[model samples]
Target: MKLTFPIVIAGLLAVFSSCAKIEHKKIDDPAYLRVFNNLNYTVSIENKDEEQPFLAMLIDPETDTSGMPVSAAIVGDFLDQRDGYAPPYPSHVGSSNSFKNPEYPGKESVLVGPVLNGFDLSSWAQIPSGKHRVMFMFRPVNNTPFFQLEERLKKKVLIDTVLQLDSHEVYTLHILQKNFRTKKNGMVLRQEVFHKMPLSDSMIYVNFYNMSADGFADADISLKKRIPQSGLLMFGVKDVMNVWFSLFTNDELRNPVPGYRFRYMTSLRQNNTSNVVQPYYSFPLFAANGTDGIRTTAWQRISLMVPGMNPENNPYNDQAPAEVLGNYAVISCYGNGTKPGFERDILTVPNMIVNIHSGTNNPQSFATVNTIEIVNGRAYLTTIQRKYPTPIY
Candidate 1:
């Protein structure tokens, strides 16, 4: 009897050890990828039936013996239709609580990555390093998940291409409109430099991309009236915009720091024909240490000025010429928080102001790189959080 009991115990131990070996193993030397749906469209009198911009990304779809897609890996499911970056502040008072509620979760709420700690890599997906067959399908802007949706609804494939990705590299795929007039769309794969830039303590790095649709004419009649030239010379060259920045005291619109002139930024090429990885432009993060004697907060406004405008004077002042006033494509500034408010109000709940020192042992302060994506005449802003010891929430 004692011998039989010892043999049974030995068999049980072996079976349990085998079960532990069935755990999920991490992928070896994976590539990271993130997708952004930047495609913009408008419904007007000319074309009343315009397709919405919602999408579902499928990578290496699995098929049955009959060649039907039985199942596949879904990288991005119902990527919410966003014209620009997600808002920085909570759109409404209680909207921030929705992300915590299990019953009502948000899109891209749970991201698949190598690790969720140490950086804001929640938007990235970890895939095998090699050639990947990617497909972006049109999806309805409804509450249903991608897999739960009807098979017929997922038939429309907008972008189907094979991408060769290298190990340990990061890439951002953008779905953009080829031309606003033609309503054609295409994708641009941008390799992101994830490494931190060599910058001073009070500086942030930024770069610009001119992804504005081709043949996009400014429809602002008031701007045309101010310029007032045959063929509207200003409208003829609307694709080009000069970037400008100004520092001001808290809510002090009437007065700005004296002698702070706009610098000449590199002219971005039209239609995203410029280099995929543009050179970074460094800007000082003005300290709010009350040295200026106005308040403990300083605000910086970035304006996109049209070509031909003189950079010698302040464009916001009334004393400036009408042509200068009308030439601005868009102007943006930092806002309250990362969670955008309900309704996504651009004016009130604008771009987030991330504290570069948030996740570190250093004192908390606002310092972050503002990623400004200009689409058509509007500018969408999103701040990149600096890496620190602690993970970014």
Candidate 2:
């Protein structure tokens, strides 16, 4: 009886092997991408392909103007919460947790949401890889998408472009909030190849953000160290990257120059205007015990903040970002305010603090960088301006 049972099991194994040999297994290895909404407002995006386009919102802003679709960050926060990853980002207002972004992790499965809200911090969207004609449009907080892209872009702000992607590689199309200059030309959405930050403590990279509301065309931006020129990212914001620093520095000068200091100056000139350009601000590039908390190299970011749509924001919030060194940053306007005595040995110096307020009216501080650290990455959040610079031409 045991021998007979063994023979039957062997025969069953042979049948399974035969079936396995005949069956064909297929594998798909497409490219990958992720969208990050860094603009201070809600945004809807879509892949404009002829055959099968990728759309973020189920409701079309063009067709349904008021169907305010949630943003990538909002969606990401919700998904993470549902997957047992969070209590949910603060903005989640639905009641279902069965949601999944069909474009990633798996095919297009529906998402069940729950009601909650969050700061929408670090929310990112993963998408199928491919070449795409991406259309990025702005939707107000209520999700009321009210304009045909072609018509809306004429009077409003949007970005349209084509991009190629590869398998397993993650890409980011970060949106920055700049002014809408429809009469100028087609402005592509603020995009960047997001490299995962290196884990090393001494790692350094520059994220130059331009949230200036100068009401001018895209300008030629550059960074200079008291020398000759040139220059992350956001919609109206742009970053001049590719700068690196040693995890550590030598106390003594490496070259023979008698004196020693590394300082920087930034220049911005409107692309549509005359060649008359000016230096924004200048500051020391490094500080003692810098990487720990200094501004120049430690912060890893240099932002240009100019007041935009929010008129009240001008000069006050727009003047300088409230940061680690606000006491120094907000006052150093080359003319106005005193440079208080502080232990410079402990803090890093900022390079881009500037008087973006009307140079004509605030000439004393105009074309001058503020001494305070202007919060560069964010769009909103500032104290009411108790006073404004004199209006200039």
Question: Among these predicted structures, which one has the highest TM-score?
Answer: 1
lDDT of 2 by residue, 38-63 (tens): 22222223212211111233211222
What is candidate 1's CA lDDT for residue 315?
53
Go through the candidates in order and give each one's C-alpha lDDT. Answer: 0.53, 0.26
- Give me the candidate number with maximum lDDT: 1
Clash count list over all predictions: 13, 50
Regions more than 4 Å wrong, model 2: 1-124, 137-140, 143-162, 176-200, 211-262, 265-393
Model 1 C-alpha lDDT per residue in residues 25-125, reported as the tens digit of each score: 46687776766677544445555665667777778877557543556754466654453454322222234433221110123433234432223544455
Q: What is the lDDT of residue 223 in candidate 2?
A: 17
